[model samples]
Target: MRLITQSLLVLALGVGLARADGETAGEFDYYVLSLSWSPNWCIREGDARDADQCDARHDFGWILHGLWPQYDRGWPSFCPTRHRNPSRSDTRAMADIMGSSGLAWHQWQKHGRCSGLSSDAYFALSREAYATVTHPDAFRRLKQPIRLPASVVEEAFLAANPNLSAGQITITCKDGGIQEARICLTRSLEFRDCGADVQRDCNLNRATMDVIR
Candidate 1:
């Protein structure tokens, strides 16, 4: 699923045809690369897929969520044909960074398949998109819960990645805790402004970023 976008949960089931050739229904404007907070996901969905990542001893911060193709307002999904499944080695290589094998598979089936790239190429692009952003260290491993204005979190990220701006990212919060950081980028993998709908939902008031440990 392309989390933080219109097709957020479409990848949960990974519906569609799997074709040998890589063909998409259409092209997209840009991409929204989502980096979900591992600790937060473990806390909420520990019993779900990828329990190993939820272990208290694991020190994961923001793991690759999904690199979603996007339009200015909406996105395309369930395209005509799908790309083949990722190779065993590719899946293994991305497992640690992606959090789960199921996620990697589903992301390709649902979102990545529509990107007009082979499963291998689409995932490779996802990795590049993941590396395009520079996350703040404070959120990576907070020993204790920190309470700060959501703007501080956004500003921290902005400072870390000079190319990003206030409108280019969103600091998503759920149950009053920091959820994930959603960033907008061009098809060229360059930093860019997000559409209004993709902008951060952070508040000016104090918010909480619960430590992953």
Candidate 2:
């Protein structure tokens, strides 16, 4: 019995250490494109989605588009712009990272219709490269307003979208900086087009997605 208990304790300790790296849910300010392992994305079914889902080995040939920062335009060889059209396809392409399991994801829609290439957000773990790590403790209790940087991200949003009649950007932060952020979805979400800087006003929504009346 003593030996068995000792072995069990050792096993439990090993498991804990393995997951300790996962405890820290990295800061999620906005969103990231590619995460790790540099996944390969390709087009499928015209409205098809995901890169690795179609090709993996020589899949780099199909990369149409990806999230920002993670997969910036610095590398033209990786982006597949010919097939990427946020106005049409609801899904987009992306590269995956290792140890990124259990990451929360979302799809953006403007004015009740889908808009923008599907971007991803994750909890960074250790380094900025691995910042995609998510916080395990912030679940259910995670309820905070979306905030944008005053001079940088905020000002840009106000200038890009004309729908924001309020012309004001608010930042909701805890440590004097943003940790979580979001704007109201578009009208297609069934929400009214109230005259204020809503969530949709910041990001493209159904109304914004459609250029034609």
Candidate 3:
């Protein structure tokens, strides 16, 4: 009876750890800062709906998608089922980078609500995370298509940012061009290794990154 009880206790502890790393609402282990390559996004998603971002007037490179809270294998979303409306000041502050008021609100509603932070604090953290990453010069403007191994692209980012490593990020592609760089961060917004399940998504031997002019 004593041995059986001990085994049951160990199993219970393991289960608890697993739950902490699953889709537990309003609770998370870290964050995934998704930096979208704007040129590829425009090409794939079209420029009509988000004309302000995809238009010729704004030559955006890497833009913030969202600071998404993540668990080990999964993440939480639509948490609490209710969210406060973003203030004008916060909305305007995030607009230039996040692309639009609607996108900003949607991000907060889905990802931010699960962050266990208020609207003001969550947006502030998102800005800080965006400022933390340094983009390589090659990525600043892709006047022509640049084809390189996806790992090489990840290395470029690692070289530019001192605190990051190969395991901390994954390069994602779409429509024959690099679409985004999904990087892992601590809850406090420091660079960290992603969970094992966050594998590299681009299968091409060499990937292209199209530049926006």
Candidate 4:
């Protein structure tokens, strides 16, 4: 039910982004934020009973808080208390996952060509960091993932979000030494939308996964 609801929200958002016409940037951000953050784990853990129970059982130092009367050692509950995520802060964990950033941000500055997609200003990052933020067409550099200061990216999205219509986007480069970035999703982008086979790669909840597709 949670996943289904988030999926519908994304469809509404994409539709809203498309046909809403003539809205302000901030308005767009506000709208998008709802979709971006919908499946966010940290944001919702406070309210979900299953989540709370799981936290108490596994995450909270393997301590059972006794709140969950039906707790079973092996049986899977709706919340699935079997596994617990160790770290919650997104950016830090992703950097660790990527295995030491093969591409240097500074290297991109010296040898990386614009190839007509990325802006020159995006080079604020070092070669290693720049290399980490990659999209499919990394060599052809056509479908490049954006890079900019995180704050810059956030503000730009926030600013232009309200006024956007279909096919419009606000781009920013990563700043603050791009070890990694976990953009605060105001709305949800379901993992399924990212990729059904690789939803775990995205580390998103089912709620987030629903809308991504």
Candidate 5:
């Protein structure tokens, strides 16, 4: 009888601990605006895929990766929403900043659904959030690949956006190269300090930053 009781208790606890595929929409603490360094991404993975964004014709620099709703600790994704999904034209319009319509659709399906908004509204908010931050011209002017401390990237961003502090942003690295710059914001889109988990910064002394195509 005691063993059966213990087993039942464990089962109950496991069920309670399990996370759902979809969280409730419109409930989150903050947002993370992720900007990918296009050239670095191209070198690492995009070029192999023959991604159009990597083409010299695009001349892409930092592109919008996603505008994600975040919790203070973890984040919500693929949440069920009452709003309708974006149409083909809607996603295509965002390609100018997002690099591809495919990314726009993916972002909407994953992160935007959790915003408690229609796809159009979510994309609009994403664009507005993106425009609020200035991409440092110094990076765009890079004539050749450079290896520099990852912290230099963060400092350049801070200089460009005076309202932003070190706590509000983080730089990430992958494949031995600079990857993305993620900035935290309030629900209202004002700059805010990131949660502890989101505040992890790449401490690379020399991370390669590829030149813009």
Candidate 6:
């Protein structure tokens, strides 16, 4: 009886972990649109990997990282979905905004699957969400790298996009460089306040913002 009870307890724990790791598709409350600073990404990881995004030819600045479905609390990923996966061509078309077809495919498998939309629909919505916000031109016009507070990045975004508020967007830092700007939006693609879990703002006083390649 003791051994049987221990086995049941272990099974229950395993089930709990699975639930925490993933959730049902189309059940999220909102979306988080992440825009990555390409130069900073190259400086931190892409340069080492010789990623094509780091190449000077692309001249990418803020690129769409992913459009993630979010819950009010935590988040879901890798959720099982009935929709078909995107073909190579479908993902390749997103490369102009996403930086890479590989990243587009990965996003479809992870966050896109959880969106409850088909691959094409998910990509469309992601594009629409990205276009809804105006990227600050100042960042793109920078001739040299500068160190500035992460909040200033957020302020620039807010200034460029008056609809977005401080609570609706967050700036993140990685490896001491300005990383990504995440904005929360409703499922209908309207700006909305981010959930507490998604409001982690980087407090760096002088985070490096790399210039466009």
lDDT of each residue in 92-130, candidate 1, tens digit only: 678777877778887877778678788888889999899
Alpha-carbon runs more than 4 Å astray in model 4: 1-111, 116-122, 125-160, 169-213
User: In model 4, what lDDT does residue 165 have?
Assistant: 22
Score every model by TM-score. Answer: 0.81, 0.22, 0.82, 0.16, 0.91, 0.91
Provide the overall lDDT of each model, using Cα atoms, as 2-decimal numbers: 0.77, 0.26, 0.81, 0.24, 0.95, 0.95
Cα error, candidate 4, residue 84 (Å) = 45
Model 3 TM: 0.82
User: Which pairs, if any, clash in model 3?
Assistant: 142-211
- In model 6, the Cα lDDT at residue 118 comes to 96
TM-score order of candidates, best first? 6, 5, 3, 1, 2, 4
Candidate 5 segments whose C-alpha is farther than 4 A from its true place: 1-19
Model 6 lDDT-worst window of ten: 16-25
**Model 1, TM vs. native:** 0.81
Tens digit per residue, CA lDDT, model 5, 54-141: 9999999999999999999999999988899899999999999999999999999999999998998999999999998999999999
lDDT string for model 2 (35-74, tens) is 2111211221211644233443432211112122211111
If candidate 5 were superposed on the true structure by all CA atoms, what would the RMSD be? 3.5
Query: Which of 2 and 6 is the better model by lDDT?
Result: 6
